[model samples]
Target: MDDKEMLFNSGILTEEREGAILPPEELWKNKKGGLVVVECPQRIPCNPCATSCPTGAIRPFSDINDTPSVDHSKCTGCTLCVASCPGLACFVIDLTFSDDLALYKLPYEMLPLPVKGEKVLCLDREGKCIAEGTVENITQPRKDRTYVIHVSAPKNLVREFRAIRVVK
Candidate 1:
């Protein structure tokens, strides 16, 4: 089946679909802080990602069902939207973290939160363990319960790493 068909049938975003929503190459590659990546493919009636953007990088929606359109130039990668997205589709990738590693900030709501410097099992879109990663930081906004977990993993796996499991 085609990527879109598989995505619709399985609810796991294919590489093509995910790439389609990514910020421009130059902007995401050259931007210092990082860039916000909204993986929300379905056009549902949701606006938290857009409304929570402090820089207006996630453009205001014309309709409630509009998918997020990011203006990468204005994005500071503060990750406020990551914390606010109920669907947990938002992420931030910082390629400048290291030569061999990329920093990924993902929305995590699971209990027994991992701590900084803890080793973790990096998971892909299907919740399958793909690689080992380290928890660099975990930000829990007082207002929102959704925690944003910062992880560092191999740069080559940037497209594959989505979520993490706390290793026992």
Candidate 2:
């Protein structure tokens, strides 16, 4: 079997309800798995984020024009892709453990970022907060201008935490 087939067979090509979800590499490990719903509309010339991944958990395979994807099994949810994404289109989520809690790793490039201890409302792809959550932490790597922000919110809202209130 070819790589694409293998990837798909392994659930790389996940069941996306819409464009909110990332394809390969980023599907929910199970039906109850945590999800990062990317809503980036354009797939122009962008490759830095995928190319910078240390685990190759992200597929930067052929053309840069292709949308970057994630491999949840291989992905440690390290948020490397979060920092590397030039378009700031990558995110990390951990939904394996709890029923009421979901941890989100997203990119933030803005002034006055929420502190680790600050709580914020969790928003969906359309910018509406479905639930309330706390900002667990933040990481800003020099290589990637994007700041990786870890937010802890309701587990049920895992599939909805896409962006905070900023642009990258």
Clashing pairs in 1: none
lDDT of 2 at 146: 83
Per residue, candidate 1 scores C-alpha lDDT tens digits across 1-168 of: 998799889989997876787778887776776898888888899999998898999999999999898888999989899999999999999988988988999999888999999999999999999999999999975275589999999988777788999977
lDDT tens digits, residues 16-126, model 2? Answer: 534445534335645232444443434578777667777776665598687666564556566666776666667777665456666787788878788877877676655
TM-score, prediction 2: 0.71
Q: Which has the greatest TM-score?
A: 1
lDDT of candidate 2 at residue 87, scale 0 to 100: 64
Indicate the residue-level lDDT of 142 in model 2: 46
Q: Which candidate is the best by lDDT?
A: 1
Which pairs of residues collide in candidate 2? Answer: 25-70, 25-71, 26-70, 49-84
Instruction: Give me candidate 1's TM-score against the actual structure.
Output: 0.95
